[model samples]
Structures are given as C-alpha cells and as structure tokens.
Target: MKTNKLILIFCLIFSVHSFAQPKMEEKKEQIRALKVGFITNELKLTADEATKFWPLYNAYDDKQFELRHQKMKAFKGRMEADLDKMSEKEAAALLAQMESNEDELYQIRKKFVTSLKGILPSVKIIKLKKAEDDFNKKLLEQYRNKGPRR
Candidate 1:
C-alpha cells in the first residue's frame, strides 16, 4: 500500500539522521582504546610487566563493569524519580541502593589496587592513577571544547 511505502520512507530517513549522531557506546570504546595506549606509554610497560599486568587489569575492569551495569539496571528508573514528590520509603530505598553501589565500587577499587601491587611496582601504580585522572580530564576538556551538540 502507499501508506506502507510512506512509513518505510520515514523510517529510512529517521535511521539516517540518528546514525549521524555520535553514539555513546562508540565514544566509550574509543576512550577505552585510548586509555590502553595512554597507560601503556605512561607506565613505560616492559614486555614482562605488560604481560602480567594486562590480564589482571582486564579482570578488574570486567568486574567493575559488571557492578556498574547491575546498578544501572537496578536503579535506572529510580534515579529519574522526582525528589520532592518521591515518598520517604522510595527515597530511603534509592539512597540505600546508591550507598551499597558506592561501597561495592570502593571495595572493587581496593581489590584492584591490591592485585596491581603484585604485578606493578608501586611507582608504576601511582603513575597509572595519575594517567587515569589525566585521561579523564583530557576527555572532559575535549567535550567542553566541542561545546553542546545542537
């Protein structure tokens, strides 16, 4: 039918326009790739250190990602709730969940630091922290320089 054809045309245009936008997932992967290279260079990782470091680093990242994904799924709707209209019970629950997530995030970082201690020198680990902070700062700066998307 003509209506069906019109609908298909609309979908095609919409898909094309949406595709032009910078996707968040792609941006994240790009940053992640850059971080790998940045950290490798910053640490001046030798073959031996890189070999031992990457596997442990990857495991820690995976755990952290899992925890974050879990929190997103659990709190996605709750996070967007209106504060003033939210019941005390709902607010308390959301706060408790947020607190729990923060605690878990901190614990994972502590565990990651402990694991890194076995693989990297303390100096390299310190450099790694600085490198991470620098990478984030640079990423933020780039976003700011780009200004808001229309």
Candidate 2:
C-alpha cells in the first residue's frame, strides 16, 4: 500500500512539472510571429513597397532562418538541458555561438537595408527604422508584463 501511494505521488509530481514547462515549438512559433510583426511595422510599407518588399523579405528571412537552425543544430539536444547544470566551458561556448549568430543577423540587415534604399525613399527608410524600434519596445514591454513562460 505504501509503495502504491509513493508511485501515485511521483506520477502527480511529474504531471505537474510537465505541464509547467512551455513547449519549445510553441515558443518558436510565437517568436516567429512576433518577428513578422516587427518586420511589418518597421517597414510601414506601402502597397507598392509591400509587393516588392515581401518577396525580398521572404528570401532574407529564409536565409536567417537557415543560419539559426544551423547554429542550433551545432548544440543539438544540449539546449534543452538545464542551464544551471552546464559547465562554464559549455556556457561560454553557447554565448560565443549566440554572438556569432547576432553578428550574422546584423550583416543580413545591412544588406537588406541597402536593397531597400535602392527601391524606397529616404523618408520611408527613417520610418522603417522607427517602426522596427517601436515594435521591439512593444515586444519587450509585453514580455515583461506577462512574466516568464509557464
């Protein structure tokens, strides 16, 4: 009887812990959508710009997406593992990878901005930068208000 009670307790605890953790794929999708929102707001793109921008944007996004996946693939299952348990070396390595990924993103943005400038007005370029900043600020506010993922 005591053994059965212990098993039940264990199962209950496991169930609660599982429910408490946010699913990785769900978080990825949410972030992806948020990024899309930023892109839209930042561009404040007109109908004509939208027609031109989207195709190019899609290509750029795809490239960035590939880079992210490539970086993540390097770490494999270790990302899901507990951060607290990671060794200093592991953590440092991860940070370096993150920095490299960030640099790549910056380069991609620079290239795309040049592309946009060729087809867009200087005024629109300023608006696009402002829009991007505003979108990021909003996302930060929302995330902070909501607290950490469940």
Candidate 3:
C-alpha cells in the first residue's frame, strides 16, 4: 500500500538522520569499549558469561563514575581555592576531603564487588579486582612517564 511505502521511507530517513548527527557520544562509547576489552581479557570470559557480564559491568561502572565525579569536583574546587593562599584550616579541610573521597571510593568499590560476586563466580570476581588494580597501576605508570599534564 502507499501508506506502508511512505512509512518505510520515513523510517529510512530517520535512521539516516540519526546516524548523521555528531558523534559526541562516541568518546563515552570508546572508553566503555576499552573497559570491556580490559575486563574481558582479564576475566577470560566465555561467550555466555560475557553476555551477562558486560551489562552488569556497565551498570557498576556508571555508579562508580557518579561517585568519582562528585569527589573530583570537591577536590578540584578545594585545590583551586587553595591556589591563592594556603592555611592550616585549608590544609585540614583538604585532608579531610581527601580522606572522605577515599572512603567513598572504597565503599563504591565494595558495593560493585558485592554486586559482581552475586553474578559471577568467586574466581571471576578475584580476576576482576586484579584487573582493576593492574589497570590503575599501568595508568599511573603512564602518567608518571609522561610527566606533568599540559
């Protein structure tokens, strides 16, 4: 029918237009893909496990990012404030903030680990933790070798 033909044309145009839009979301997707690559290799996930693991991992990562962003904002704000002048009060506040951020990060990690354990075997959970540590170590080394940020 003509109506069906028109509907198909509209759908095609919409799909094309969507794809034509800017790839602003691509950076997030690339980072996510890199994370999955790291996890998949480290965990040695089987196809069936991967199917379940990625979705859960993504959810866990999103929550971690939320917590981290909050801590980062607070830390950066304090550091900016301290640039003009430093005082014992400022130092104490920064120390407390840093400690709180560490605690929050630890708590977030614990929650993610618990959730992951519910979905994965103990060995896989251990692997995930090791992978995270290894990733952090490598990232730190890279930054150290690169010198100060521009």
Candidate 4:
C-alpha cells in the first residue's frame, strides 16, 4: 500500500512539473512579444530599416543571452559552495571569470553597435539604448508591483 502511494505521488508531481513547463514557456513568449512591440514603437523603424535591423538585433540578443546563461550557470554552481570556506585561489579565479565575462559582454555590445551604424542613425542608436533601459525598468517595476507569486 505504501509503495503504491509513493508511486502515485511521484506521478502526480511529475505531471504537475510537465504542465508547469508549458506555462513558463508561454510566459517567455509573452514577454518576447512585449519587447518586440516596445522596441518597434520606440525605434519608429521604417519597414525597410526594420527588415535589416531585426535580423542583426536578434542575432546580437541571442549571443548576449547565451553568454549570460553560461555565466549564470557557472555562478549558480559557485554560489552553492561554502563561500567563507573558499580558498583564495578559488576566489581569485571567480573574480577573473566575472571580469572576463564583463569584458566579453562589452565587446559584443561594441560590435553590435558598430554594425547598427550602417542600418540606423547615430541618434536612433542612442535612443535604442535608452529605450532598452526604459523597457527593462518598466518590466522590473511591473514585476515588483505584482506582489508575491504562489
């Protein structure tokens, strides 16, 4: 009887996890749609400009996301370790990894902006940066205001 109960509980938990995965993906898609709309409005991109711009922007965004995901994965592992007990060499290595990640991110941004110059005006590129910042701030504010999740 106990074995059956354990198996039933496991199946229930697994089913709920499977269901939740789709919801999480749906949420990501919603946010991506919102970001696309926000950026399109802010840039006021001409149809021709948008045709050229989106491909470049999407590529850059993907690269940035990939790098950030890698960095976060590594950081998460380090975080699980006992920080106070970490050796000096490990601490130094962590700092070096962080600085290298920051530098790589900066280089990526520089390359992206340089590429943008061909498709967009300098002023519009500057506006794009500000628009990105504004969008992030607004999203964060909304998330904070939403209160605790279940």
Against the reference, the lDDT scores of all candidates come to: 0.77, 0.70, 0.70, 0.79
What is the overall TM-score of model 2 with all chains considered together? 0.52
**Per-model TM-score on C-alpha atoms:** 0.76, 0.52, 0.63, 0.82
lDDT of 4 by residue, 1-79 (tens): 3433444455445543443454776666556556666777777877788899989998998899889997769887997
* Superposed model 1: Cα runs more than 4 Å off: 1-24, 148-150
Give candidate 1's error at residue 137 in angstroms: 0.5
Cα lDDT tens digits for candidate 3, 1-116: 34334444554455445434456476355435445656666777777777787787778788778778876887887787746587888788889888987898788778877877
Candidate 4 scores a C-alpha RMSD against the true structure in Å of: 13.5
Provide the lDDT at 126 for model 1: 96
Tens digits of lDDT, candidate 1, 88-149: 89889888988999899899989889988988999999999898899779768866986778
RMSD of each: 13.1, 15.5, 10.8, 13.5
The most accurate candidate by TM-score is 4
The sequence of per-residue lDDT tens digits that candidate 2 reaches over residues 30-104 is: 555555545554555566777887787678878878887877687767787898899999899888888888899
Q: Between candidates 2 and 4, name the one with more favorable TM-score.
A: 4
